[model samples]
Target chain A: MSFVSLRNVTKAFGDNVVLRDVDLQVDEHNVVCLIGASGSGKSTLLRCLNLLEVVDRGEIEVDGQTITNGQVDVNALRRKIGIVFQAYNLFPHMTVIDNVTLAPTKVRRVSKADARDRAKDLLERIGLAEKADEFPDRLSGGQQQRVAIARALAMEPKLMLLDEITSALDPQLVAEVLTLVRELAETGMTMIIATHEMSFAREVANKVCFLDEGVISEEGPPEQIFSAPQQPRTREFLARVLAAGRL
Target chain B: MHEVLQKFFSPHAFRVSLPDVWTGFQLNLKLMVIAEVLVLVLALAIAVVRGLPGRGATPLRALAIVYTDVFRGTPLILVAFLVGFGLPGLNIKGLSTLSNFTYGVIALTLVYTAYVTEVYRAGIESVHPSQRMAARSLGLSYWQAMRYVVIPQAVRRVIPPLLNDFVGLQKDTALVTVIGVAESVQQAQQFSQNNFNFTSYVVAAVFFILLTIPLARFTDHLIRIRERRERAQLT
Candidate 1:
């Protein structure tokens, strides 16, 4: 069985359907990149897997546990699946170290000292060690996004979801965040990254899934999807991204 | 100029009334401090109840809504009279025996809590929904998320406005004089009635200004500092 599985997952917000009969599977330690246009349900799909949004239909299992069912402890399940957002929603009232340590100390019951140590290590890894005492508002957008990633990493999650994490960064800062994700991929972390950065997705994704509207129109190894996409919609989307010199 | 000013000001009468007003001012300060604490705690509780999510909290939400609307709409002085005299008049065994001062505190706390609840609710709502999402996505339970993440930020943002309400509450302590609690305004009025001079009222006004000016300036200082920090962050 795949480490993460979504079977016939459907979600709607009032009258607007966001995800329609979606089915996907990701093996352990694999990097799956979800590439699509804006409003194509990439972010919503990631939200559902983390239980941030409930599915109107179908089931989601992470590591053989059915996370979508109401019987599961949602909070405990969330601890196993970390998600980073496009806007870098760091707790502004907290210092960078506090933001990183909060979940570990509060949710996981890690000792304060131990959480601080782990947060420092994560900050150092993200090249934000010196910013430990600084509040989120003081940091640049790129730095804040990195700290957000570190905040997620502190949980030691089994599967990490990146929801267009670089979409909010400046063109110059995008490379730095993408490089960090590439390093995580190298370290064998299972990740499903929703991204608009075609080149970064191509470089890091083991399997690339092209989403059109609310469903995956085409999915394959990066080389196959990028060069020889079978679906016309996938080809059309890629042609526009390529024309924009993004791939 | 000095002679003309002295006729209206009556510095001698003002000085003579100082000790008397000081005692009464002390009572006002005491009420302000105690009621301030109670208002902060009670108002936050009410705001949280109104903000509670999902269908299970509907009745509680409705109760909180009614409470805030009723108390906020009623005049504070009327509330003072009702609690101070009316409750005791009902002759509920234990409640009837409580001092008028305690009733004054209760009345002020209830009235101020309603106003503060809306301030707190506005602050709590101003925090971007994404903050809740971020906190929850980290496995923090709903209450845990609110306590550790949301409330702290909300309280910080509302501090200036909260202080403004506190200043208003401090001044409104004089309103309890109508309930016969012998606060500064009442003592000043008694002195004026006896001596047939209004100078004691000036002393009471001075005491109130002295108490509230620092708080008002401090609130302004906090607002300035917050503005500067936000502006600096934008750059």
Candidate 2:
């Protein structure tokens, strides 16, 4: 069994099928990137992995545990995985430090002091230590997003999911957030990124999966997938990304 | 003009009725305070229950929905009569013999809770669903997400509206008089009937105005602060 595995996973909302018969595997500490067009099920796939959206039919096993089983504890399962969003959904009412420490203290039952200390350290690492006491609304988009990443990391999750974390950022601000992801990759934090940044994927991903119409049409190493895509759909997506100057 | 002022706002009537009106107003104050606390807690519970996700909570949500719908539609005076006189008429032993004050509290609580529950539900809905998703994605349970993230933002955003409802509650405290409870309006009515002048009613209105003006201003201040935060990203 791999560190993380999804077998025949399918999810739908009413008549709109978001994911269908998706199979993927990730070894511990490997950075896998899912690249595709919008509405291609990238975000939904990550959401299902975290159990934010339940799979209509499939088996998802994380760390040898079959999380898709009905009896599994979703909260405890989510504690092991951290997922960040494109919009950087930091709690607007909470300060930066409070946002980071909330899950550690409330969900994991860590002591408040310990959570605060860890949150402070994570903020420092993310280069937002000075913005600790400031409310999220007071921060710039990049700063808020960095705080959000720190908030997720504060829990020390086993696997991180980055769901187009930079898609909503200003073009100039994208690098700072990606720099932190690269640093996390260097530290060997296992991550599955759903992103549109093809060049970033090419540089940072161990493997890339091209999702087309709710299915992983092709999967392989970044070098192979980006340079020599096997499927025509993969070629077309890369061509479009290239034409848009993203790759 | 002087005669009109003298009839409605006479010094003699004000002085003669001040003591009695003030005493009666204390009962109104008590009802407002007690009812406000109960509505604050009970409304939030009903609102949360109404918002619980999945089919498992269908019955519970239905119950909460029915409660809000029934109470929201009933007039406070009618509720006061139903609770005040009707409960006693039910002759349900221990509960039937309860004081009119307690009955007044119950009526105000029921009616105001329905109104406030809608306010709280509106506030909760105003918070972007993404906020709840982010909280849940971090391993927080649904209630935990509501407690630590959603409700706080929702409550904060709706403070002005919540206070607006409170002003309505404060005013409606007078409705308890219909239940034969001697709140300020009833007291003022007595003095006005006896003296054949409405100055005592004017005196009661002044007292009510004093409390609500401050609340309205505070709500405005909070609104201004929130607006500034959104517009300028201020600290």
Candidate 3:
């Protein structure tokens, strides 16, 4: 069985339907990239997987556990999955080390000393060890995003969702955050990345899915999806990306 | 100008009335401190209740809204009179045993709690919803997010405004004068009647100003420090 599976998932905000009958499968240690235009339900899909948004209709199973069933403990379910958003929502009131260690010490009941040690390690991995004491607003955009990722990884989640994590970053700053993500992928971390960086997606993603409006129009290995897209929508998107020099 | 100064700020009259006015101002100090403590605790509770999610808290939210609205709209002096004379007039069991000073404290607490509850609610709401989402995503329960992450930040942000309300509360402590409580304003009125000099009222005014100036300045200092810190982060 796939490590994570979404079956006919549909989500809507009031009358504005953002996702429609989307089915997807992800295997262990596979980096799946979701590509689409803005408003193609990519963010919402990621949010639904993390149960941040309740689906109008569907079932999601991650690691053989049913996410849609009401019996599952939502908090416990979330502990296994970590999501980093575009805006790098670090708690501005907290120091970097404190932001990363908060969940471990409070929710996981790890000793404060142990959590701090683990948080330092994560920060070190992200090349932000010196910034552990700094507040989020004091950091550059890329640095803040890295810290946000480190904060999510502190939980040691089995799957990481990167929702356009570099979208808000400057062109120069994007590479630093992308480099960190690339390292995460190389280390065999299972990630579902929603991104606009086509080259990065092609280089890192084992599988790429092209979404249109609210549907996954085409999905295949990156080599096939990027080079020879089957769906007309996929081809048109790639053409637009090419014309804009993003592909 | 000389006559006005002599009537309002006469040195001899001020010195004569100082001891009596000082006694009355002590009551004002006591009322303010006690009322402040009560307002802090009670207003926070009400604000949290009002922010409670889901239909189960509908009645609670309604009650909180009504309480804040009614008390905030009513004049502080009227509330003081109602709490003081009306409670004893109720003639309930063991009601008359409570002193007028305690009644004054109760009245101030009720009105200020209403005002500060809105302040607290505003502070909590001002914290971006994304902060709450980030906390919850980390596996913290709703109340845990609020208790540890949200409330501390909210309280810090609201401190200047909170102190602003207390400054008003300190001045309003004189409202108990209407209920025949021996607060500074009442003592000043008595001194005016006895000596036919308004200098005692000046003494009382000076005492109020003395207490408020330090607090008002402290509040401004806090606001400046907070702004500087926040701007430093932005740059």
Candidate 4:
């Protein structure tokens, strides 16, 4: 059984069609990298998986439970699937520790003492324990994204979604966040990332998917997709990324 | 100078009866306090109604727009007259018999709730939609997200504006004097009428300025804190 699956998913915003009859699957404990040009619906696809953007038509299952079409309680489904955005959307008024602990304390109804201890441990794991009491404003973009990751992990999600999580960071800050994601991959956390960092995608992902105009144009092992793509579009994309010296 | 002192500064002339001043001050405080509370509660309700989900949202928004436009378009003194005198003549049975104080409270609440509603709406909207999404994605219901996350931030965001509104309420309490509610300003006017001294008028001005200046400074301090936090975020 697939750990996560989307069957015949379709989405649209007004007259603009975003995703059309998209089907995908993620096995447990695998990193799947989705690469696409601008406006290819990669972000929209990730949002649909988390139910942040509901599917107009189709079924989405996580750990074999239906989450789309109002059949499943969205709150319960979302708690099992964590999502990280390109922008580190940390609550500005909250301390880092507070941000990490909020969901567990409020939604999970965990005791304050347990939440605090767990938050501290997660912050330390993300290498920002000393900055726990500081506000998100006080951290660098790289540090802030790490805190956001820690915040998502506090829920102990079964699957995590990364929507170009490094794109919004500064060039200097990008390497640190990618490194963190690489470590998470090594730990066998199931992840689906929509990203432009082709080198990191090639290095860390087991499977590579090239999304073109809201459809998966080609997909294969990273070795085959990066160096020996079969589709002309994928080859052109790789050439541009290689000329830029990234892939 | 001696004549002037005797007329305006003599202990007998300047000495106000403690019981009368105390009674008047308490009534004034009560009026302002109750009016402020009522305005805050009603404004929040109106803002939520206008912002709530559904087809009814448009009509609620239209009603809020009209209420705000009419109240803010006219002066509070006019509202006082309509509530205190004009409405009574309609002899709406039970309503006409309400005390002057009750009429004053009703008028002030109606007038200020409109302004407060706008303040609250701006504050609630100032919080980014992402914060609400973050809360909802964590398994909170929509109302839970609003009550715990959105409202707390909204309250913090609008504190300076809300405090400014409170100062306006403090000064607007004097409008009740038009309805014969004997608050401090009205009591002072009565004293001056009996003795033909302008000192009572001077005292009233001093009292209001003394009360409002500190609040203005405090609001300034709060704005500074907010600005510093914003700057920190950017840098």
Provide C-alpha RMSD values for all models, in order: 1.6, 1.8, 1.7, 3.0
Please give the ranking of all candidate structures by DockQ, highest first, separated by commas: 1, 2, 3, 4
| Each candidate's interface RMSD | 0.7, 1.1, 1.2, 1.4
TM-score of chain B of each: 0.96, 0.96, 0.97, 0.88
- Tens digit per residue, CA lDDT, model 1, A1-247: 8999999999999999988888999999999999999999999999999888999999999999998878889999999999999999999888999999999999999999999999999999999999999998888889999999999999999999999999889999988898899989989999999998888888888899988888988899999998889999999999999898888
Give DockQ per model, in order: 0.87, 0.81, 0.72, 0.62
Model 1: residue B114 alpha-carbon error in angstroms: 0.2
Question: Against the true structure, whose DockQ is highest?
Answer: 1
> All candidates' lDDT scores?
0.93, 0.93, 0.93, 0.86
Question: Per-prediction TM-score, please?
Answer: 0.97, 0.96, 0.96, 0.90
Q: B1-235, model 3: which lDDT tens digit per residue? A: 9989888888999999999999999999999999999999999999999999999999999999999999999999899889899999888878866899989998999999999999999999988888888888878888988987889889999999999999999999998888888988988989889988899999999999999999999999999999998797667
Highest TM-score, which number? 1
Candidate 4, which CAPRI tier?
Answer: medium
State each candidate's chain A TM-score: 0.98, 0.98, 0.99, 0.97
Ranking by TM-score: 1, 2, 3, 4
**Model 1 residue A65 CA deviation in Å:** 1.2
| Off by more than 4 A, model 1 | B1-8
Native contacts conserved, per model = 0.90, 0.88, 0.66, 0.59
Provide the TM-score, chain A, model 4.
Answer: 0.97
What range of 10 consecutive residues in model 4 chain B has the weakest lDDT sum?
B13-22
